[model samples]
Structure formats: structure tokens, C-alpha cells
Target: MNVRREGTAAKAAAPTKTSGPPASLREAGAALAGLSAVFLFEMLDNSILNVALPTIGRELSASATVLQWVTGVYAVVFGGLMLALGALADRVGRRKVMLVGLVLLGAASLATAFVTTAEQLIAVRAAMGVAAAMTTPGSLALAFRLFDEDGLRVRATTLISTVGLAGLAIGPTAGGLVLAFAPWQVLLLVNVPVAALAFIGIRRGIPADQASGPHRAPTDRAGALLGTAAIVLALLAPTLFVDAGAASPLPWLAAATAVVAAVLFVARERTARHPLLDLALLARPLVSSGLAFKAAASLATAGLGYLVTLQLQLDWGWTPAHAALGMLPQVVVLIAGGALIGPLITRVGLDGAARLGAAAVVCGLAVYGLLGRFGYGWVALALALVAAGMRVVGVVAGTNVMRGLPADRTTVGAALVDTVGEVTTGIGIAVSGTVLAKLLTGDIATATWSTQQTARFHEAVTRAGLTLTVLAAALVGWGISRARRPGAARTASSPGH
Candidate 1:
């Protein structure tokens, strides 16, 4: 065959084998709507559980420690499963796994409503977490497979972001409202309908891609185990530290194990015929740098979120509803910014978008740090500056990192991004929460005067906020430092024309 003719033939065969969803506008719209339902399920799960916690504790007589587990288990289990399940989605079928996750999550939610005891509730919570672990990677992987074009992916992701924002806005309020009208059962039960809807839509909308299985080399079982162990233990580290701290054997032992596992994972994957993860791929500057940038951005966002909520409710005495409402501006800006940045980045390039976004995070965190360190007040007034700053930080960094990578790696990429983000958030909240709690404990003990006591309380609260903001700043700076490597310049924006 003529070399040029052979090249042309290969190109012709590629479209037939690898075309995504139908190119028709209507087909694309249907697919996006399905993805929106998936987003709703995820966001609702993420945001609604907080309100349900108080109710959960009340009904089950759960201790403060156990209550924390209610939220943290989901993160731990989901983080653990990222690498393993992400590869599963690629090899088995993203559409199949995604739908299964939706159904499982919904069913777990429904079952959680009837828990009569703390252990039952904890068990159900773990089940719900596994469901989330299964859900996110597959849905993200499908987005990559379903929309192969850069512009289309951006449009889809932007809409997905919008669904996320809406869910975040509505879930807490909806949880509050549900509790007011119904019992604690209603909190978990509400997920049933949302997840079911997503499951149905996904079943109908997503087409089956070719499967990877026995025909390919054996699966990477050892790498999966090691990587899962590393991530899961890392997420649990902070909570464990709450009890163990640095001096205790458990936390230190856990960390040592993770480090050893990491070394083993690196060694095994380097030589395995069918390694669990392709560590070599991450060695690429494009992969490693993008991962770092995204991780930093997420850490800043989570820190800002925790600090804002604390400052509003504890320091400023806002009602829970008001506390949730304070997030409105950030949500609005994040939604808008996330949608717009894809196209802008497509024009501007990845590194430019990343640098621009990282700069925004720096500004936002600085303002937040100042506010946290100063005198506090009424909710509406105190947030006037800090809210916008945090939101801008969230949007710019979130979009920049996602746009920096390739479509083929999206599942592992997204899971890696999410794992780093949640782990950071968990650690930040755990550390900051500890400091705030300890300072309060010490100050209340050593009060010389009532006047000084009130001032001390405010000061401790301010310091807590400052702590998180400082951490946020450090992460954003790290993002800026490592961004120039490999794929950080791609700028694949979501939700665009």
C-alpha cells in the first residue's frame, strides 16, 4: 500500500471504530440531560448529608465521633475505590457501572431511612459511600467517551457543573425543609427519587462501548489493592489523627503503611505485564502537573468552604439557613465562571488559564485570611467581601485544572483530582477544627475576666478561619509552581458553543 494511502485508510477506519454518541444535536442534548441527572445524584448526596447528621445523631443516639464518621466514611470509601473502579469503568463499561452505581446509591439511601441503631446507620452510610465511589468515576469516564470533541466536552461539563451548583444550593435547604415536615427517614429517602431518575436516564441515554476483558492482558489486581489502600488510609488519616495524633501508634503506623504501599505500587507497576494503574503515564509532565494543579485548587476550595461556614455560624451567629444562603454568591459565580472559562481557555491555552485562575485563588484567600483575622459580625455584612473572593478562587482553579488534561485519562484523572481534593478538605477541616476546639477549651479554662473571655472567643474563631485560609493559600501557590509542566496548557473548557 502507498504510505499516504495507508495513512488515509487508517484514518477512515478510526471514525467507524471510535465515534462517540450520535453527532446530531438532539442526541447530544438527550445525553447531557442524562448526565445532569447523574450530577444531581452526586451533588445531592454530597450536600444534603450535613443536615441529616443532626437528625441522625438524635434518632440513633450517636456520639459526636460516630456522627463524624457518617460524613467521613463516604469520603474514605469513595477515595479508596477511585483507581480500581476507574479502570473498571474503562475496561468493563462506563455506562453499565454508572447506572449500577445510581441504583445502588438510591437503594442504599432508601434503606438508610429505617436504621434503628447507630451501627445500622453506620453500615448503611458505608454502603452509600461505596455507591458514590462507583458512581463518580463511571459517569466521568462516560463523559469522555461520549463526547470526544473538545468543544462538546466543555459544553457537557459546564452543564454538569450547573447541575452541581443547583444541587449544592438546594440540598441543604431541602434537607431542612424535609426534616421540618417529616422524620429523619425523609432525609435519606429523598435520594431515592433523584438517583432513580438518573439511573433511568443513564440506562436509556448512554450507548455501550466495546469492553476490555479477558482478551486483554490480566487485570492489575495488586496495583489496585495498593493504590486503594494508599488513598483510603490517607483520607482516614485526619480522623484517625483526631484520636491518635502524631504520638499515637495507629496514625503513624497507617502513614508508614501507605508510604510503603506507594513504593510497592510504583515498583510493581513498573514491571507488571498488566499493571493495575499505568504509573508510567503519570510520570508524564502532562499527567503529574495537571494532577497537582487540580489537587491544589480543590484543597483551596474545600478549605474556603469549611472556613466560611464556621465563620458564619460560630463567629457571626447566622442561622443554619442563613449559613447555607451565604454560599449563594460563590455558587452563582462558580457556575457562571465554569461555563465561560472553557471557551476562553480554548482560545487562551491551559497554562494561561491556570495562572490566571491560581492568581484569583491567591486574591480570594488573602481577603478571606484578612476577614478571618479581624473582628466578626452579622452574617450578611461579614460575607460581603469574603464570599465573592472564595467563589472566584473556586471557579478559576476548578476550570483550569480540568481543562489541562486529555480525554482518554479523564476517569483516573477525575478520581485522582477528587481524591486529592477530599483528602485535603478532610485534613484541613480536621486540623482547623482541632485548633479551634482546643483554643476554646484552653481559653475557657484560663479566663481572667468576663470581658476578656468574650474577646478571646472571637479571637480563637478568627484564628481558626485564618488557619484554613493560610492552608488554602499554600495549596494555590503550589498549583502555580508546578503548572508549566506538560499538559497543563490544553485548556479544554466545558459548557460552550
Candidate 2:
């Protein structure tokens, strides 16, 4: 496994002219601000939609399946296209690709405001997802151009990451606040102005993508398309199965199609001249573990977000705003946890930090499983632990993965990071959504369920959450253990190192 070297592929592909005024703290701040706006909006969109979903369903008369698609489709499309687009960004220009993405995002978001049906809304969300895929990788990759020094770059990365968490933390609150005074469509429209602002900032602050000399390899269209097909099929199956009969063949057919697409994608990657993504990276423990751990973190955070929003609004009869406010404690802990990760890493090595994070997730899940029967107050406490765990995993995993990658492969590596995160988040929501639907189906089918049934439904939801969290926790622990192995290589330039 090749450790990432400074100024290898990235420098060659997106070379910065050194002749002008040297990059300053001001430029770095500007760059981060622009990128943060884009990241925050994307994260906010997901969280806000989760909060507003119940309301949308009531208004549109959407079925449970349509609601899941509204959320899951975004992640699926975003994850599917990012690798190909990331490669394109590296070859063409990150700034240019990002600007195009912002424009598309703004337009799509504005169009979504007029979507009158559940199907139209789902389609618009998918378009937004494609735009997000284009923007996210460039948002992170462009930081390399803004900050020349490794120390400065790492600091910028941390801030960008923290802001992402902040977006997650604030989503429910923001959505709830908006829903109080306006229609739920406001949630989709809000992105229009945010995207426009991001566009202006990025166009002014971000440098142009200089051409890499003629030796760069060609893009892998086959691998990219196949991978996208696989993801679309994979994400579609679970949502479809949730509403279908146990004996239905559609779910099995979709799952098999996904498997076939995945196999073909892998086969194509192994032989492609310029693969959409390199399979060899998985052979390195650090890169592989980082990917797995990030997925696990998403499972804990996104899954919890989906479940809690429903538990508060649907089961407990809380207003959207009230449900959003109920999550304040978790957000607070997420902020604190982000602030403390550097110190914790200093006290404990990366491996130790990850283990702590994995354990925290498990502890949080255990609390939810055991004591969630008491009240949402207890669930909030569990959320705090999960938030802390997310912080630790979010910080440690990305840096370690980058450290393990070859510098030339940085663009793809970075894209994969975001892809893993988005994809797992989608999976998390799907899995949790399925479980909740299954648990509540009988209750929901009754003309009117008793209060006892409602209470039981809530308990069942919590238990299911616990089951998912435990499974996620185990995956995270396995990744951490793999990363700790003696042969696991490290990059000297990695932030925590």
C-alpha cells in the first residue's frame, strides 16, 4: 500500500500557479466559507426532509414506500455518480465542476418547490442528488489549492468536517422552525438561495482548475455506469420489499440485479485502463477500515435521525418544531465531541480513538435498547453518546484513509470517502425505515390503534434501533481492529500523525 505523498497526483492534475500572492489565512477562510455553505446545505437538506417527511406525506397522500424513496434516492444517486464525477473533476477542474454542480443544484431545488406530487418530488430529489455528487468531492478537494501548508490544510479539513456535523445537528431545528410559519415546500426552496450564495462565493474565491499535462489517463465510463446501476438497484430493493408481500418476487429480482451489477463493476475495475475506482485500495487496512468505519458512523447517525424524527412526530404527537428542539442535547454533544477529537487523538493513538468511538456507539445503542422504554429523554441521552461516537469516527477515519492512499489517487480516494458516507447513510435510513414500517404495520392497519398499541409501537421501534446500532457497532469495531494490525501502514503527512 502506497502512503500518500505530497504534491503527487493532485499537484499534477490541478496545479496551482505559485507566482501570485501566496495563499493567506484570509483566502483559506473564504474558501472554507464557500465550501461549508455547500456542504451545510446538502446535509441540511437531508435532515430537514427527514423532519418534514410526515407532513409531506399527509399533504401529498404519499404511501410509506414513496416517502422512503424521497430520502433514499438522493443518497443512491449521489453515491453512484460521485466517483466518475470526481475523476472528471480531477481531469478537468474541481472548481469548474463544482460551479456547474451549484448551478444545477440551485435550479433543481427551485424546481422542486413546484412539484405537486410525490413522484415529482422524488424525481427532483434525485436531480438534487446528482448535483450534490458533483459538488461534494470538489468541495473537499479544492482545499488542497487554498492551503499550501499541510498544517493549514489539516486545520481547514477539520473545520469543514465540523461544519458538516453542525449541519446535521441543526437540520431538524432549522426545518422545524421553518415549518412553524410556512408550508413544507419551503424546505426544498430554501436550497435555491443557499446554492446561489455558494455559487457566487465559489466562483469568486476558488481558483480555476489548470490542465494536467497530456499524460493523464482516460476516465472509466464502463465502471462508473455499472457501479451506478448496482447502487440504484441495491437501494431500490429494500424500499420496495418493505411494502411488498414476504413472498413477492420483485424484491428478489431487484436484489439479484444489484448483485450482478456489482459483480460486473468489480470485474470492469480490475481490467480498466483508468478504473472508476481502484479495488487495490481495499487491500490496505487503513483505507479499507476508514471506509467501513465511516459507513458505520453514518449508520449510527443517519439511522438514528430517521427513527427519532418519526418517534417524536408520528408516535408521540409532538409538533415538528418540538421534535426538532427535543434533539438539542445530541447536537450539543456533537459540537463538544468535534472540539475534543484532536485532544483525544493526542492522548490516544488513532486506533485507540476509534475503539473508544466504537465502544461509545455500542453503549449508546445499549442504552436505547434497554432504557428507551422509559422515555425520549433517555433516547436523547443515547443520541448524545452516538453523536460523540460519530465525531470520533468522522475525524479519525478520513485522515487514516487518506494517509493510506497514494498521493496520485487522492481525487478518487476523497470521492470514495464522501461516497461511502452518503451510501451508508442511505442504507441506514432504508434499514431503519424498513424496521419501523414492519413494527408498526399491524398497528397502522387497525382502523384505530389503542394508546397501548402506540406505546408498544414505540418500544418496538427502540428495540429495532438497538438491533441496528449493535450491528453497526460491530462493523466499526472490526474496522478499528483491522487498522490496528502491525502491518497497517501509516502516512507521515496524515493530520493526527
Model 2 spans > 4 angstroms off: 1-27, 49-72, 110-123, 144-151, 172-186, 213-215, 245-247, 309-322, 349-351, 375-377, 433-441, 445-463, 490-497
How does residue 449 of candidate 1 score in lDDT?
31
Taking the tens digit of each residue's C-alpha lDDT, what string does model 2 give over 1-497?
23455546667789576655235656556667888888787778888888899999999899987898898888778877888888777676678888999999989988876888999999899999989989987776666446555445545666777787788777777888999999998888888888887888788777665565111678888887998888777767766665663357997798899899999999999999788778987767888888878888877777777777777776677786798687877788877666687677778877677678867877877787677667887889888988888778776777667667655455567788887776676567667766666666564545456877787677677767777777787787679777877657544344432
Can you give the lDDT of residue 471 in candidate 1? 67
Candidate 2 minimal-lDDT segment of 10 residues? 488-497
**Candidate 1 Cα outliers beyond 4 Å, as residue runs:** 1-26, 211-215, 242-250, 318-322, 375-409, 434-483, 486-497
Q: By TM-score, how accurate is candidate 1?
A: 0.81
Per-prediction tally of clashes: 8, 0
Which residue pairs show collisions in model 2? none
